[model samples]
Target chain A: MYEQLDQSIQQLMWDVRKRTLKRMQSAYDVAMKTSYKDLVTTVDKENERFIDDHLRKLDPNAKIVSEEGLGDKVTDLKGPVFIVDPIDGTMNFVMQHRNFAIMIAFFVDGQPVYGYIMDVIEGTLYHGGPGKGVYCNDQRLHAPADNDLHDSLVVLNSGITLNGGHNFREIGLQARGVRMYGSAGIEMIAVITGRVGGYLSYLHPWDLAAGMAMAKELGLSVKAIDEKELDVLSSNLVLVATQQVSRDISELIN
Target chain B: MYEQLDQSIQQLMWDVRKRTLKRMQSAYDVAMKTSYKDLVTTVDKENERFIDDHLRKLDPNAKIVSEEGLGDKVTDLKGPVFIVDPIDGTMNFVMQHRNFAIMIAFFVDGQPVYGYIMDVIEGTLYHGGPGKGVYCNDQRLHAPADNDLHDSLVVLNSGITLNGGHNFREIGLQARGVRMYGSAGIEMIAVITGRVGGYLSYLHPWDLAAGMAMAKELGLSVKAIDEKELDVLSSNLVLVATQQVSRDISELIN
Candidate 1:
């Protein structure tokens, strides 16, 4: 019975995400007529409102923390909360029309229970509930084998190295190679799919919530600074990696 | 009659590229069985030989300059020449299946007369001939409206700020934003489609050949350092952009 309910919710969320993507695409096509760098279009705001409304109707008791500032201001993660990032990679969506993802995470008393990351253009969904295993589209994902730092690839902001921001230069030297794809949601997908061993970046709650759920389900580590569980309300440098690689990288960075 | 011949050659080249993609995919899938980065397959030589053999029958007088060195070595581009990169973005192809492209260019008397950049995963082709308009799949591209640096989005390797390999740090500061997608072919697509105002990177001739052709046809400037036509045999920092944006960026970098 619980499985049926979860599937039903998944289907509803999937439909909502697809509709939101279409609307965003149309708005983006129109916005191309003007300057591309201007942030927060009407479509972005409208889409967030639509999702928030639908989620509210579905779970009236759920507290929402969203990027667009339409949700409650709860200081603590005390109850059922839906963390939403209406558009995780706004710049990528506004400019490239690819590499952007819609991220949503459901947390119970500050612990994640379910997560979903959708690649809009490719129509791929990465989602899983606690202990239910992760899925990319319809297929199940097995945990990627344990790998070391030298044999692993990473996703990071290249500007970190250039600007001497947050010890990124040292991190770059430790990894075999680094890739910058410019979208947090897409970067999370790479980590879950084992294309890259880990992803580290400074991100907001909406950006990290769904990805944290998916990463945890894949047997990958999802932690805040110093290997602690993430604080859902504040921005921090997060790292998601295999246990061994995470240990190696954490020791180096910390 | 000439049009039919051109179409036939295009079809043959496209088929060859598709096969090459499949071979690489198989190698990657098998490698994933043991480890992700442990296998670096040597299909580059075989793929180049296969493509060169096929092109020879269609254009017997065409000189071939391929990455794997399977073709003739001509000192001067005196006649028809086929520039080929059997596997562009080899690292991405070896590590991740989604971000690579196959590039081919046809030059006549030392000038790019035709070119194709195929995104193998998505199966989209950006192709054009001299005197013909550029295309993505079958849709024609209009030259994007002129954009200024402050209003423009640019793509560059994120490491530019850290490695100081090229003058990327200064350019990154000047643009509205910077994106790094990890493949020269895909990055070129961002510019051709007007999602980005420009792309700058140190690239080899085979890597830039097809992209240069498509960029030029789309009314974007394709220039080597010092603002000269690119020599088709050397590695250099190449820039592709709208004429106005390119000029603005050149001044900033200089």
Candidate 2:
């Protein structure tokens, strides 16, 4: 039922990728947010504006929620909403010149309907939601086999791992190893592809929305560590992984 | 004087890349070493043998030291010594199927003469030593600006960071951010390219040899964290970074 919408969103994401990649090649301006570690750039603002314009034109009544303040002031996802993080991992983009992504999710009546996460430099897109199977580009992705937490490789955020919050250090010890790529979209995609068994991080709405939307469809479980359903408008300590691994992490963290 | 030898090693590395990339596409055998977190594969051994054979043929009198147990046992870095980690980041190779590298170093009279670290999947090679400047693929890499420890992004090993050894936790807290890519070769390349300012971890002779050689050519300091000269034949806690940042890390850790 949402095929056309998914395709349209996917096409728009590619266009965003093209524009973002071009901007990455040239020099750009950067501004700090919250702390020195948190970053935003001119490319981020420009990409948000571009996606917002395209999404508004695609569905005039849809509410757009984005990172760079170019979208509607979104309080709740009660109606059609496009949640966007125009440049996820801006720190990576500004510093590493790679490993960043563009993310978007379309929700209707507070239900995730379509999601997209594009690793811009690598040109790989992880997209889908609900009945549509998840995909990395043209290839369909199956639900990953449920590996136990002890047997899995995990992507961890640097702060949480060091802080020892949520018993994360114990979890790190049990896991095969931990990788830190500093991009939520790429980390989620790693789980979807079975490259890593799980990923855990604290994230804002735009950062978590799109990846989580697709994560669920791939037969992975994504949730707030507090055991409540994720609230679309609020930040959450999120974990996405195979069902068994997610359960294992929840037990440890909780 | 080493131009011919350097060119030959570079050509051999490309050949290794081709063989390894093709093998990565197919199934291969993996064996655990020390622990499940440590892995070795048939492909690793095969690549090592391949490189060893070529190196022997290129300079028949040179003594070879390799990770895969295919090279001679040498007590010291006397005469012509070739150190090879045919596949650094073997865990990455087995788990992520990427981020692994082919690292090689050539030393004569215990002096580093040439070094090569090939990020096989990305097809970017970081190679050179001493009088020759470092190059990432074809582009010459200049010495990275001596950013302070607080101003830099650092790549750290997951085990060491969480273990809180070498004052690593303090370093992580102080840096702009910390990253863990699981490949020392790629991490060192990140330093040479200025994508990251420093990398530190415990490493074996094969793992440390190549990258340290290239690092010195880029005007980066590579040293034993204990403020002693490295024992080339034994594992050492190592740090590779810009001069000032290395000193800063040294002071903090010491």
Candidate 3:
């Protein structure tokens, strides 16, 4: 179950979260990471450093793979590993000053053990993994009720949907509604909490790492858009949703 | 400019808002007003009644047209008229319990004078019209920067998008992103606050009445999809956006 490990991770996450909130209150520099569409701020780098130091202290033997390049060269997940995104929605943070999140995933021998997705402004921590089950803050969250695509609200990525990438527009039409909150972590948390039925995006390892872990525990399916399984080491066009929703979406899109 | 009327209406709105918040805290009844898609709650009825009574008290001669059948039945906007949607985004209120708003528009001799759209939960009020510049809460809102169709977020109605109404799929693809917040008032507010570039929906008079007033003050263009001027008394495929965005979207779709 890794209950003990979950508890430990939760504690570490809260500490990191508090640090992040404090940093956000102060002015920080911003820079483009890939394009103007992709951004990083001083807060992201500082938070990454803070989390990296803490993780190193928490489990010296564990390898850390993080978004900010402050961790090890993580080519394989053979040993205990922590995948981290210091600030998951940097664009939202830079623009809306809300909807951003901090994420961390704990894995052992290539299997997810625990995950945490913390909404920085809302002060929510969605954390857990398979066997232990998922949770939002202190409340134990039940898996979302199964609903057909036509009866559920789903989250979609803006660029992907607009570009017709992965047939997102067709899938979006089937859902009761579509929300674009601009944060993968926040969107996945919505799926786990049943606020939305699913979230689809082309995401990097760090973007989906924590969310995928928690979602799996909630009996939600997390997989590649194509008929392939996901590997933690790479990026994929991912779908996180209830089993029926995943099946419905794939059947329509594929 | 109706400066004195704006002040008086603002006071009345705050009172109604306070009452609505208190009522929301207590248990309330819900019933379908039309189909399963349309809903009315004790809260909606109560809020409508409260606003209607207050508006009557404010101006006995003014004709009030409201969504919940609590106001006057006037055919034309010949005198001082108030067009109100006591609770815009009723479905959102019924399901998500948030993202809904209270909307009101004041007209004098068939010309829009002042408007208000208040997000109850966030406690932010967006109000203004015509010669009066729009304001979000206490701060004045400048007109959003002009962007092309491919550079801005647009909000759409789920039913319309899914049904392929008004070439929604093609229009959605042209925008930088699409968001569905389930509330017309909130979506319009997003446009006013520069959170999104535009919002298009097939809306009744009560849905667009309030937003249309304030949007015009911010130099945004509100029009029908068929290149016709909005009647504001009839349902139409409405487009609300900056001048450039509106032109780009219309050119691409029409």
lDDT top scorer: 2
Worst 10 residues of 2 chain A by lDDT: A161-170
All candidates: TM-score: 0.91, 0.97, 0.85
DockQ of each: 0.43, 0.75, 0.36
Model 3 / residue A52 / CA error / Å: 2.6
> In order, what fnat does every candidate score?
0.43, 0.66, 0.31
Candidate 1 vs 3: which has more TM-score: 1
List candidate 2 segments past 4 Å from native: none
Q: If ranked by DockQ, best first, what sequence of candidates would result?
A: 2, 1, 3
Cα deviation at A211, candidate 3, in Å, is 2.1
**Model 3: per-residue lDDT, tens digit, B1-254?**
46877898888778778988888788988787875557789888888888888888878999999898988877888989998888887776765667789998998888889999999877889999998888887899888888777667678776766655677777777765567777888988888776778788888888898889988988898999898777877788899898888888787664
- Give a tens-digit lDDT track for model 2, residues A3-106: 77788889999999999878878889999999888898999999999999999888899999898899999887887999999999898898788889999999
Error of 3 at A149 (Å): 3.4
Question: Using TM-score as the measure, what is the rank order of every candidate, best first?
Answer: 2, 1, 3
TM-score head-to-head 2 vs 3, winner: 2
| C-alpha-based local distance difference test score of model 2 | 0.88
Error of 1 at A128 (Å): 0.7
lDDT rank, highest first?
A: 2, 3, 1
